[model samples]
Target: MPVLSTVGGSGRSTVAGLLACALSAMGSTVVLDTGPRLSSPWPAWSSEPGTGLLSLPPDRPLTRGQVHAAASRFPAPDGGSWQVLTDHQEWSHPPLPLPSDPAAWYQLSAIGGWQAVIADTVHPVAHDVLTARWADSTGLTARWCHLPFSVPVLCAASTGSGVLALQTAVKAASAEGLPLHRMVVALAAVGEGRSPASVKAAATMLEPRVRAVVQVPYDPRIRAHGIRDTSRLKSRSLEAGRQLARAVVSSAEAAWGDPLPAAAVPRTRAAAQARVHDTARIASKKVPA
Candidate 1:
């Protein structure tokens, strides 16, 4: 099962949304908002009807039929064939309690041929549930961890509390042996303005656990028109998001020992090397060289 864990500022939701669009554009019928209430303001599914997570009974054990029903609820956007499944529930503003049978629910979802499941999560809850589920599900593996570029307003609002929370969560997940694939660091800026250094700093702190760090240039159009659909984004943002998603997918495939398409492997390797080169350059510049 393809699972993407997006951990960053609130904008992670938007990143997840863009990924869903990218997957759809690639002709994979995707399930967006697989987790409980969506954190980002972007639309969970594509314009196609019935492509989102199924709202299920959180308090009770979910029956197979209930699971199937939930999957059936989402129709393909093109009225074509597709699979469905339930993601985590969005209970409240902060976060809801983990479902009693998270493993079973995750397994049931995996039965469907879900190419990807992007989860937008908060700190402790995101880490706890994903780790538990990954350990339990023989089929499930983490594809990537997304971190959006830090916005000054968001930083001021977070007041350093968010960074601390992220660090703590990453430590906890690592302790639990969660395989963190890649970390996509988004820089949501207007023009030539650089992404906040704090964002890169946070990503650097996560490097040991996060195998890759991708820089996604910020696009003002996403905020202006409220980029709910991938088509709504400029070509640049869409291409950037797609590249990040591909990296995440490659990381997951490598971890599982699954063979990837020959054409894609070289590009992924090149991207990884580029990241190492960029990090080395940045580090060299930072020193008294």
Candidate 2:
């Protein structure tokens, strides 16, 4: 699934982290980081040494183990965690060839092991449908929209302008033949006194049109510290994450018109070895009295 918004500060990363954390309860979850050029907060929040998305193999058919190994861990609930793969380059270093296409991002999540993958995407994919960028629609934005068995989690700030942008975005996406019927919309609270009439009205109109419209409550912690500490997030915020996850699955089910197919491919032996090493490292953290 891809978490996207046409505008910035729509809480894409926060939603992504929450969804990843909430989805981890179902099984293993991993995050395909959104930022590479300017970068996301994945590095700052992570304690482990970052392997980075660039560290992943450049081949078309990537090895699941190697790809998984490159991910940086983010703590989740119940002692479990999710993985994030992003650029950890320094400011002075010359930029490397990063994977800008949706194919590369999609490939990382599809390799295997993870039961759920949340792709944190900042690109205005829906907005692209109405722009000159639509000519090359076979790339990132369109790919996210048209990919099979995929669900798009459209996010918007709970404000007048934000809702307006989302309304336009959804309309453009529908015009481009994207699955608006199976899409999930998220309204992120911007700490306003209350949702403006426009935002509320849009949600009401879009509710029956889309799968579901969820309102993510404003959490002061998210704004002050970013999405690093999931444990400290408010209960309402976490509940919203769970709601988004369920909504995503429900939309997927609606698209399938039946039970969704399960992932059956086994992870590589190398992946198992990696897990063993990870377990050993975690165990090494404990000290005897």
Candidate 3:
């Protein structure tokens, strides 16, 4: 699963951290940091000195076993353990090349000791290693400055380039046999700033465009202390995280569609070429004069 925001400041990283923690409370979960924005707050929040994915040598592609070994455990108050894999601050390494094979990336979560893997990625992967096709589901974050029905609530074309970018990525991924389960997170509504009617309206408005809509109230605790500080987390934010996790898990389970299929085949040379062709076609359709 990829936690992606079309634009910056949609609180994608915050959501990813909470989602990973919530998932961990239920089962083993690892959050792979592939984005450049903000580093995973796990290290700052955890009591133990931790290791990150970037700690491993970047000379060769990382293996699932290696990934598992390198993961730093962050224990939740409920006794569940959350693991995080990110770059280490101590080492100066070159930009790492993510696994080019989407299937292999997918297999990492399916086969390993982990129950789920949350991939934190930047938007517009045109230059990034993790392309849209690599994701089985995308947690898209959209900001709502208004309290109720407003113009461009779902996709403010003039203000939000992320909407179009996300739509394009979803379409392209679908074309490549990866149907993205879109979990839209509506952000920046606090206690009085949020109401049941507003939340319901937002979900209803987004229902047609996304699989599910989850609203996370803006918590001053998280904003001030960062996501790593669990001690000061607000109850409302925690509940929202749990809700989002349940929705994501349910969507994933439903996608399996009873009697999960056998393991997927690796991407062969021919398949890679076909993917290139498909991507080129998609690009051609969008290119302007």
Which candidate comes out best when scored by lDDT?
A: 2
For each candidate in turn, give its C-alpha RMSD to the true structure in angstroms. 16.8, 12.2, 11.3
Candidate 2 positional error at 67, Å: 1.7
Tens digits of per-residue lDDT for model 2 on 51-161?
677677665446677777788887876678878877777767776576667655555677746778788886775556666354654546567766657788889999999
Error of 2 at 119 (Å): 1.2
Model 3 residue 57 lDDT?
57
Query: In model 3, where is the ten-residue run with the lowest total lDDT?
Result: 144-153
- Give me the runs in candidate 2 sitting further than 4 Å from their true place: 60-62, 132-139, 257-259, 262-289
TM-score versus the correct structure, for each prediction: 0.53, 0.84, 0.63
Model 1 over residues 1-289: C-alpha lDDT tens digits? 2233324443554555455555554444434333444543423342333322434544444444555445523232234333333343344445533433324333434433344544433333345546666577422222222111100001101214445555565555555455444343343333445545676577676556564555555667656555433444577776766766676666656654465332211123346688999999997875554
Tell me model 3's lDDT, rounded to 2 decimals.
Answer: 0.54
- Candidate 3 matches the true fold with a TM-score of 0.63
Q: Which stretches of candidate 3 lie above 4 Å from their native place?
A: 37-49, 58-65, 91-112, 125-192, 195-202, 258-289
